[model samples]
Target: MTQLIFINLPVADLNRSIAFYEAVGATKNPMFSDDTAACMVLSDVIHVMLLTHDKWRTFTDRAIPDAHASAQMLLCLSRDSRDAVDAVVAQAGAAGGTADPNKPQDYGFMYGRSYADPDGHIWETMWMDPAAVAAGPEAFAAHELTPV
Candidate 1:
C-alpha cells in the first residue's frame, strides 16, 4: 500500500478552520469529521486533520505553541503553474487570512507565495517547472536564497 500523509493541526476554532481550508479548495471528508475535528481533503494522499485545541491535547502532552508568535512548521503545497499559486493565495486573502506575510519568491523556473491562516498557521503555495526540477541542483545554481 502507498503511504499517505496526514497533517494534524490544532485549531482554536474548528468551524472557522474548516471554512478557511474549504476556501483554499479542500473539501471536508464527512466520514472522518466530527464536532471537535475535521478531515480536510487536500488531495488523495494528503489530508489535514484540523483538531480543536482540546481534542489535540488528548494526543499530546506538550503545550500548543502560540502560532501567532512562533512558527512550528511551514507547510507547502505545489501548484501546476505560477498562476495557480497566486490564485490560492488570493483565495486565502479573501477568506480573512493574511496573504504574503513574507516576501514573495520568484526564480525563472520557480515561484512561491505564503499565507497565514486566521490562527496564524503559515502555508506556502509554490510552482516549479518540472523540467527545471528534473534538471536538479544545476537549475538552482544561479538562484539566491533570500529571506521569504
Candidate 2:
C-alpha cells in the first residue's frame, strides 16, 4: 500500500491560503474542502490540509505559533531538475509568496530554494542528480563534486 502524507496547517485565512497553495501547484480536492478547511493535493502522495484557527483547535490544544516570526517546520518537495526548483520558486514569488526566504543551497549534485506562503509557512523545493542520489549520501562526502 502506498502511504500518503497529510500536512495540516492552521491558517489565518482559509480562502487566502487555499489560493496560495493553488498558485504554487496544488489543486484543491473539492471532495475534502469546505468552509472550515481545504485539502490541497500537491502530488499523489502529498496533501496539505489548510484549516482555520477555529477548526485547528478541534485537533490540537497547543497554541498556533506565528509562522512569520517562528518556524515549527519547513515543508519540502522534490523537483526533477535544478531548473525545475527555480521555476517553482519563481511561481511562488509571482503568486505573492515571499521567494527565497531561506538561503538557496548548491552542492553540485544537489540544489534547493525556498518560499514562504502568505501565512508565513516556508516551503522548500529541491533537486538532486539521479546519479548522486543512487550513489547515496556518503558518495557526496567522499567525492568532490563541485560545480564547474
Candidate 3:
C-alpha cells in the first residue's frame, strides 16, 4: 500500500475531543472508533486517531506529556485563502480554543496564524502560495512575524 498518514494522539476525554474535532470540520469514522478512541477523518488517506490516555499509552512505553504545559504536537491545516484561515481559527475559538499569543506571519506569498485547542494542542492555520514557496523560505525573513 502507498504510504499514508495516521496521526495518533492522546485525549483526556474521548467525547470532548470528538466534539472539538467536529467543530473544526472533521468527520467521524465509525470503522475505527468506539468508546476508547475516535478516528477523525481529515481525508481519505489521512486519519487522526484520538485515543484515550490509557489506550494511547499502550502504543508506547513512554509517559504521555502534559499537553497543556508542553506541546506534544503542532497540527497544521492549510487553507485555500487568508480568509479561510481566519474562518477556521474563528471556528476553533467558538469551539473553546484560544488564539496563540503571537503576531501573524506574513511572508508575502504565505501567511499563518496559530491557536491552541482546548487540550492545548498547537495548531497552525496557514495559506501558502505555490509561487511563494518557489521563492524559498528566505523570502519570508524580511516580512517576518513582527509583534504588534
Q: Best lDDT goes to which candidate?
A: 1
Off by over 4 Å in 3: 134-148
Candidates 1 and 3, the one with greater lDDT: 1
- Arranged by TM-score with the best first, the candidates are 1, 2, 3
For model 2, how does the per-residue alpha-carbon lDDT over 26-123 read when each residue is reduced to its tens digit? Answer: 99999999999999999899999999999999999999999999999988889999999998899888888899999898877889889999889999
**Whose TM-score is greatest here?**
1
lDDT scores of the candidates, listed in order: 0.93, 0.91, 0.82
Error of 3 at 26 (Å): 0.6
Cα distance off (Å), candidate 1, residue 123: 0.5
In model 1, residue pairs whose N, Cα or C atoms come closer than 3 Å (at least 3 residues apart or on different chains), thus clashing, are none
TM-score (C-alpha, index-matched) for candidate 1: 0.95
Model 2 stretches with alpha carbons more than 4 Å out:
143-148
Please rank every candidate by lDDT, starting with the best.
1, 2, 3
Span of 10 residues, lowest total lDDT, candidate 2 = 139-148
